[model samples]
Every structure is written in C-alpha cells, then in structure tokens.
Target: MSVQRGGLGRVTHIIGEGLEGRIANRHLALFGLGFVGLFFVLPILLLIPESLNLGSTTPFESYRRVANGIYVDAFVRSFLYGFVTTVVTLALAYMLSYFLAFSTERVRTAMILIIVPLWIAYIVRYFGILLFLSPAGPLADLTGFETDLLFTTPAVIIGLANVYLPFAVLPIYNSLNAIDEELVNASRVLGAGKWRTITKVIFPLSLPGLVAAGLIVFILAAGSFLGPAVLGGPNQTMIANVIAQAFLDNFNIQFASALAIVYTVLLVGLLLVFNTLFDLQEVLGNI
Candidate 1:
C-alpha cells in the first residue's frame, strides 16, 4: 500500500510541473503582447494627458486655444482636396492598370515605358512639371499660356497627383491581373457589350483595388506639406502645414501635438473604413 501511494504522489508532482510550464508560457506571451500594445499606445496616451489638462506646456493646448471651427475647417479643406485628387488618380490609374492587364505584349511594353516616369525622384518630378508650367517653360513657349501656377493650388494638386499616381496604379494593376480572363471571355460570349461587361463585371471585381488606391492617395495628399509649401499659397494650406506652423512658427509644442493626434486619428479612421469595406491585405499585397 505504501509503494502504491508513493507512486501516485510522484505522478501528481509530474502533472503539476506540466501545468506550471504551460502557465508560464502563457504569461510570457501575454507580457510580449502587453509590450507591443504599449509601444503604440504610449504616444497617444501622452497626448491625452496633455490635451485634457490644457495647462501643460505640451502640444495639447491647441485644443483649447484654437476654435473648433478653424480646426474643423482645416480638416474639411484637406478632405476636399484629398477627395478630388484621389478620385482623379483612381480613375486614371484604373484605366491605365486595366489597359496594362488586357493589352497586347507591345502595348504592355509601351505602357510600362510610360510608367517609368513614376519611378523617378519626387523632387525631380516636381521640378520637371515646374519647367513645363513656369512662364519661361515649354508649355508657355509652345502654347503661349502662362500663370503664376508655380505657387498656387493647381500646382499643389498637380504635384500630388503626379507623385501618387504610381501608388494608385500598382495596386489596380495587380488586382486586374489576378482576375480570370475566362470570366471576361464568358461575359463577352453571353452577349455583353464591352462597356456593359466593363461596368458590370470588371469594375465591380476591381472595386477593392480601387478603394485601396483611393485611400492611399487620399491619405498621402492630406498629409502632404512639401508640395503645398513649395507650390501652394495661403489658400491651400493643408493639415500637415498647420501642424508644422504650430510647432515651427509659433513654437507651440502642445498645440502641435494635439493637431498631430487629430491628423493621425483622421487617417486611422479612414483606414479602418477602407479595411471594413474592402480587404486591405488583399489589395495591398497585390500592390
């Protein structure tokens, strides 16, 4: 009886050790997850404390100093310009990507050649456009058209659209390429005209990619400062420019942090909406 009892005791100890090991492993994993959460949450957490107090010399004082209307207006203006840029860029990118997806080998090669300009440096692209639009530039010399577009809203829009065109195109192209050719052929065989097939079938199938491209361009355009600062005037000041002014011009660190947080939140909200509507991973992976 003693020998049997001793054997049971040993078995119980072994089981207890196994349970402890499992618990330790779970605790380690939880700790790692907590650390990761802290990594992202720390900055936002810091802002909240500052914004709430408003007395601190941090960037949060902007919430108190600036009127809600002005902040909202800045956001609205940024959204308006971003929306226009995204819409135009998406439409053009979709057309170009679709063409690349369906065109003959020679046409594909030609389209790639056209896309090569997108791979160049952004500053170079900006200057290249400037050279053509400036008073002494090619467009003025050829068409006799001239304007102070070198520092205007139109210039900012043009610069953003050009810079972000590739970001829009690459995703649409990948999504279009993944589509089964047989599906398109089947539509054509079933008495669908080219336009009808494109509108009803191709466009719907590529919606995910379109949304991805629009979101990318919108976010990029909204957060842009360099283009607007260099090419735009007071009328086209974006949210990013506002943040810069708060920090650099006014030396208002607390207000700048508040604006920065607001800007980040807006971008995050947009991204969440896009992810909810379309599979971001699928579209981004393709791009």
Candidate 2:
C-alpha cells in the first residue's frame, strides 16, 4: 500500500513539473512575440501611416509619383543586376563547393581561404574591387589591356557576385557534403560514368541547397547599396539608391516610406512565389 502511494505521489509530482515547464515555455514565447511586435511590427505599422501621410487629404500621392516616374527604371535595373549576380555567384560557388566536397583532401584549408574575405569590412572589399578593376590597377597592368570598367554596370555585377560568393558556397558545400558516398558508388557500379552520375544523382539532390543559395544571393544583390555605390555609375544605381536619395537627400519622408512599402511588398511577393515554386521549407532544411 505504501509503495503504491509513493508511486502515485511521484507521478503526480512529475505531472506538476511538466505543467510548470509548459507554463514557463508559454510565457517565454509570449515575451519573444511581444519583443518582435514592439520592434519590427510596430515600426512597419508606423511606416504605413507615414507613407499614407495620414489625416491629410492627399493620401497615396507619393506612391502614385513613384510608380509613374523613373523609379520604375530603377526597379528594373535592380532586378537585372540581382539576376546577373545570382547566376555568376552560383556558377562560381557551385564549382568551388563541388571541388571542396568531392575532389579535395585539403577541404578545411580551402574553406578557410574561401571564408577569409568575409572577415573584411564590406566597404573595404568593394573598394578593393574598385581598385582592382581600375585602369591603372593590377589586372590592367598585368594584361596591359584596360578599357574603362570603373563605375559601370559590369563592375557592379562583378562586385556583387564576388561579395556574395561565400554565402552561396557554404550552403552548396553543406548540401554536397551531405550526399552519401554510397550513392555515388552505386551509380558507378550501375555503369554510369562520373559525369553522368554527377548530373543524374548529385545535381538533383543538391537542388535544395542551390535554391536556398540562389534566393539568398538574389535578395542580397537586389537590396545591396555598397556594391552600386562604390563600383557603379549613375546608370547602375538600384532601387536602394533611389530610396536613400528620397529620404536623405530630398528629405521626402512620405515618398521614401511609400517606396519602402512598395519594395517590401514586392520582396514579400517574390518570396511567396519562390515558396510556391520550390518548397522553401525543404530547401532551408537541407541547408
């Protein structure tokens, strides 16, 4: 009888403890939600009112002006630059990642070399590209063949690709590394050549990582300021530059806020399309 009572008491104690743990977790979740609401959500909500110029008769005037003006060209240029950067970055990163994952014995050393550039300040890195591509820079001096590249669209694309290459490499390397050696062996045993095995098996499996890396690179390139600012001419200026001009140079807060709102909505819509096209949850899980 005493043993039974003791067992019952212990079970009750465990149940109480579990209840307390759940309550604590609930409180922690609520606290985190509250913090996000206060910081992120509240600021975005305020931006809406500011963009609308609320309590005045002329609401949405800023949005109409932005939609009809040269800002549309800025949006197109930004998307073009972003697409070019993503393609270039993905190509280089995939090659490097494949070598590191499958071909290299000195993976750690190579990875360190790849990651070292990230430690440098972004402005410094962009400036370095500026100098490197200059008419009098090493590339020009080495080849003795220099046309104008400084402050150009190609320069911006190259700079963005170089800056975001590391981001693409890491995800791709992780995905490639996660691939089973047994699968490669099986493909070989099944009379598949190395290239065939890679194309049929390895590449397919690595799609998730590729998607994740591509999306990340595209978004970063689209929104980047430093790349265009340091390496691009007036024609290369992106939507971010326009937003900065509206806010800082023109001091048109309503116009800037409207641009920001539109940009955010477009980004969100793009993300939704990506999620629908590719299972972003699965892609991120692979990463």
Candidate 3:
C-alpha cells in the first residue's frame, strides 16, 4: 500500500512540475498543427491501406518492392542532397543576412532583390538556372567553356540552395534584426573585438531563427521535385522523382504509397534525431 501511494505521488508531482511554466504557448500552435494533422498527416495515414495488399498472403509486398537497389539509392541520394543543400543555403543566407542586418545601409534594396525571386514561379526560376548552366547559355558565351554542369549533381544542389535561399534569409534576418543594439554596444565596451562579439553574442542570440530556417530548408530540399527534375540526370534521381514516376507515369499506386510511407517515416526519424541533438525547444526558449 505504501509503494502504491509513493508511485501515485510521483506521478502527480511529475504532472504538476510539467504544468509549472514549462509549456511555451503550445496551445497557440494547435491551428497550424491542426492543418498538418487534418491535411498532411491524415492523408498520409489513409495511404496505408493502398500501400498494402491485405487480401493476399503477403501484405508486405509493396514495402519489399521499396527495398530494391535502385530505390535504396534514390532514398540515399535524396537525403544526401537535402543535407548538402541545407548547409550551403544556410551559409550563403547567413552571410547575406548578416550583411543586411549589420553591414549595409541599402537593406531595403537588398531585401527587395532577395525577395523578388520568391515572387517568381519555381519552375520559371529553375528554367532560368537551366539556361544559365547549359553549355549554350551565358556561362559558355562568356567563358567559352562548355560544361556538363547543367545535368549533374552539383547543378541540382545549386538549384535547390538558390531556390530555398529566401526561406533561410527571412527567418535569420528577423532574429538578427530583433537583437538589441545595446547588447552589441555592451559587448564592444567589454573589450570583445568585432569578430568575438559576433561569434559569442550575436550568433548565439540568432540561433532560434537559424534553427527555424534549417528545418524549413531541410524539409523543402529533401522533398524537392522541380530542382532535381530540371537539373539532375538519371544518376542523381531522388526519392521524389521515383514517387512521381510511380504515381504519375507508371500509375503504380501501391508502389507510390509505399514510397510515400517510407519517406515520411525517415523524415520524421531524422527530425526527431535533430531535435534530440539540438534541444530545439531550449534554444528557442531563450528567445
């Protein structure tokens, strides 16, 4: 009886502790969460039946089809390209945003330039890149060097990074711009040099934005359809391409369903690992 009472006390204590200023406006997020829940997540859940053949002796058949060597390679290629694109996009966006935040007076003009591309359709922007990278395009006209960059891995990554640059920049700039000027002045007064001040104070304060940008870019890049379709070759095909092929061209609903399920699972697993490593809630809480 004492052990039962002790356990019950512990459970109550845990719940009480959790309720004490621990949940940061989580209720407000329910609308956006509801959209994912009702639209994206629910639809994905509904695909489970289509992904299996329960009437047959082998219900796991579609999943088995996904284990093929080519399909495996596509999954690996998709994630690898996603990671590389996120890194490159973040680096470029951070530098650009830092300049916009601190270095430049023409922030309005620069922001206009950065934002203008987002107004353009993705296919149009990708097609423009296609022209620029092609052997017959402006690059070849100037350099007189016809290159195979148009239909390769590097081209695809470049396209993904460029396409997603604005997403990263906006979030990071908001974070950077929100920082108090007094804090920066205080750091300088405390004998922290320019680089030291930026690295130690500015960057840490900006992490919430950086983390938000990373998640947005990573998800978009991983599931990209147009970038790889326009810029990559057969060797560079990603999972999205295969899913498109299965669903659109081949009309293989079961195969497409299986691919979608696997991709969703893998993406969620990766995000979970990322959250664990970064302690994202803690990082954002500081903001």
Candidate 4:
C-alpha cells in the first residue's frame, strides 16, 4: 500500500512539474508578444489612423490622393528594381559563396580580394560609381567616353546591389560552409565534372540559403529609400522615395502613412511566401 502511494505521488509530482513548465513557457511567450506589440506592431497600427485621417482641413481628399496613379507607378517601379537587384545580388553572392567554400587557400586569398569592397561605406562606394561614370570623372578622362551614368536606372541598381550584397553573401556563405564535403567528392568520383558536381550536388543543397538571400535582398531593396533618392532621377523614383517626399516635401503625413502601410503589407506578403518556401532559421544557421 505504501509503495503504491509513493508511486502515485511520483506521478503526481511529474505532472505538476510539467504543468508548471508549460505555464512558465506560456508566460514567457506572452511577455515576448507584448513587447513586440508595444514596439513593432503598435507603430504600424498607428499608421492606419494617421493615413486615413485625410487632413485637419480637407478630410475627404487624402484617400483620393493615395489611390492616384503616381503611387501605383512608384509601387511598380520599386518592385521592378527590387526584383532585378535581388537576382543579380543572388547570382554574385552564390558564386562568391561557392568559391569561398571550395577554393584552395591561394584561391581563397584571391576571392577575399574581390570581396573586400563589401567592407567600404555604402554611400562612398555608390558615389564612387558616380565618379567613375561621370563625364568629368576617371572613365571619361581615361577611356574618352562622354556618356554619364548618373541618374540612370543602372545607377540605382548598382547602388542597391553594392549596399545589399553583403546581406546576401553571408547567408549563402554559411550555407556553403554547412555542406558535406563527401557528397562533392562522391560526385566527382562518379565521373562528374566540376560544373556538374556543383550543379547537381551542391546547388540543390543550398536552396535554403538561396531562398534566404533572395528574400533578404528583396526586402532591403524594396524598402530602401536612400539609394534611389541619391542615384536616381525623376524616372527612377520608388515607393520609398515617394513616401519620403510625401512626409518631408509635401507634409502629407496621412498619404505617406498610407504608402508606408502598403509597403509594409507588400513586405509581409513576400516574407510569408519566403517563409513557406524555406526556413530562414535553417538557411541562416551559422551566420
């Protein structure tokens, strides 16, 4: 009888401990959610009222402006730039990641030489392109080319690529590092060439990083204002640029808030698609 009572007590203690653990975990989760709600979610929610208020004087007119064609144009342009930038950045980062992962020590040294530009300040690096492509800058002086690249579509892309390349690179590099070497060796032993081995065995395994880097670059490029503002002219304006102009130039906080809300929705939708495709946590494992 005593033994049975002791067994029952042990079971009861285990159950109580589990219950306590669950309660503690739930409390921690709620606290974390509250923090996020206060900091991140609240500010976004606030945007809705500000965006919808129209104005102090003209309440009905604000909604009309937000639905105008200009915002739609900016949205489309922003998405286009983001897409192109994401593709180029992904390709370059993938190549660099592959080289860094599999190259011999001497090759790695050469690869590092290529990657060193990523350490430079973004504005400085972008403006350097201006200098290179400007008619009075080095390229015109040396090569005798008269065309200027400033304020062009390519300039915006280059600026965005320079700024966000590192974001793509690190994730891909970490994924490459996590690859099993034996698989590559086995592919080679089975009469696979270097290209074949990489395509067949390496790239398929790096899908997680590919998805991660692409999504990250997409998000950063999509939301970026500085690069477009500095490097682009009227034709290259983006959603972020319009939003900034709304706030700073026009003082249309409500319309800017609306644009911002739309931007947030776009990013959220993209992020959801990405999270569904690949686990960002798994992709960014070591980075």
**Best candidate per TM-score, number?**
2
Q: Give the TM-score of candidate 3.
A: 0.86
Best of the two (3, 4) by lDDT: 3
Candidate 1: stretches off by over 4 Å: 1-45, 49-60, 68-70, 106-119, 271-287
Error of 4 at 136 (Å): 0.9
lDDT of 4 by residue, 1-287 (tens): 34555788889988988887467666878998999999999998999888876446766456567678978888888989999999999998888888787775665665566578777877787788777778798888998887757899998998898788878887787788789999988999999999898899899888778887888899889878888887889988999889999999999898888889888887788777766766777765634
- lDDT per residue for candidate 2 within 81-105, as digits (tens), equals 8889999999999999999999989
**By descending lDDT, how would the candidates be arranged?**
3, 2, 4, 1
Candidate number of the best lDDT? 3
Candidates' C-alpha lDDT: 0.79, 0.91, 0.94, 0.83
TM-score of 2: 0.88
Please give the lDDT score at residue 102 for candidate 3: 88
lDDT of 4: 0.83
Cα RMSD to the true fold for all candidates: 10.0, 6.9, 12.2, 9.2
The TM-score between candidate 1 and the true structure equals 0.75
Per-residue error (Å), model 2, residue 157:
0.6
Q: Where is model 3 poorest over a 10-residue stretch in terms of lDDT?
A: 1-10
Better of 1 and 3 by TM-score: 3
TM-score of each: 0.75, 0.88, 0.86, 0.78
Q: What order do you get sorting by TM-score, best first? A: 2, 3, 4, 1
lDDT for position 170 in model 4: 79
Which portions of model 4 show Cα errors greater than 4 Å?
1-37, 54-63, 106-121, 274-287
Better of 2 and 4 by TM-score: 2
